[model samples]
Target: MNASPVTIPARRGKAAFVAAGQSIKVINTHGEQVVDTWAFNRADITEFMSMEHTRSGSRHIIPRVGDAMLTNHRRPILTLTEDTSGGIHDTLCAACDRYRYEGLGCTEPHDNCTDNLAAGLAELGLTPPETPSPLNLFMNIPWTPDGEIAFEPPISTPGCYVVLRAEMDLVIAFSACPQDLLPINGRAGKPTEAHFVIA
Candidate 1:
């Protein structure tokens, strides 16, 4: 309810392609929420991201502050930029639909999560999900010593933001985690904010 002053009616699940030098700021209007992010060279989406590239170069499955988030090509797509709470954000958790949620305990049918992701791509004029895995921004999944990851509480506070300056002409897509069963999005459900400022 206390989103930043910017008015973006199409905020949820929307893909926005900020130009080569633009900067976008994501705000967690509510504290301890998770958001997912992915970037692609505007020239070609197929030449997109790969898990091997991002995880190998930085925070592994859990991204930390000031780390470089690399693309599959070993190029820096985005720097960690800023992290407030230092809570772990997952690079391993995939977006969940009703199918995936059923196991997580959502017995009824719903498609909002996938719809939110699709909203951005649709607005960007790109096709459906092509990347094998998505890069989650504020979501937390605690890493175990045995090499397993667990979804954990959010590390961000209200108004905490991560800033990304476009390294290339990038089509950045993000989802305010619509995880009804997950803690990061706030099980109560509220709107998240995305603000684009020209770099």
Candidate 2:
């Protein structure tokens, strides 16, 4: 493990390898930025973390500490070991892509999580077979009993974080989500950087 925390630059992505039994501490540095997270088997990128599989296995919309995040093949890849960020995270939202921004009326190219994931993996001379739905950390998406959900500012405070233990040797990736058009990042509509430390 490195002695220093690594930055997930604002509106960008970062990835690293985590051996089985290692834990990653993801910090909500600014209290507002939502980090879209993914994990892939070190030996086979095609067998990546699957939020659907995890949800089915855990039987929860929002994973709690102790929940095992499963891979596409129904194997445990990561486990939620600790959470101090108000225990709010999303398991249903798909990573943002160019089409997402375009639908929001952006005429110019936007930095998005899908592209971010590819870029992060590319740095390690790796590539994901496909973009999977991400575990959105510190994201606030409240739902109604009737099934309606709305994006809202995160309730987590600065310096709060969550720790996830790797159940298998894998590559973990993160994106400091850049959704300024919505308050998901914050009511101020500003995106910020986050940090992570492996231990």
**Model 2: lDDT of residue 190:** 89
- Give the best candidate by TM-score: 2
- Candidate 2 regions off by >4 Å? none
lDDT of 2 at 147: 98
Residues 55-114, candidate 2, lDDT per residue (tens digit)? 999999999999999999999999999999999999878999999999999999999999
Cα lDDT of model 1 by residue, 38-112, tens digit: 787778776555556878876466666666667667776666566554545667767665577778777686544
Alpha-carbon lDDT, every model:
0.63, 0.95
| TM-score for each candidate, following the candidate numbering | 0.80, 0.99
How well does candidate 1 match the true structure, expressed as C-alpha RMSD?
3.9
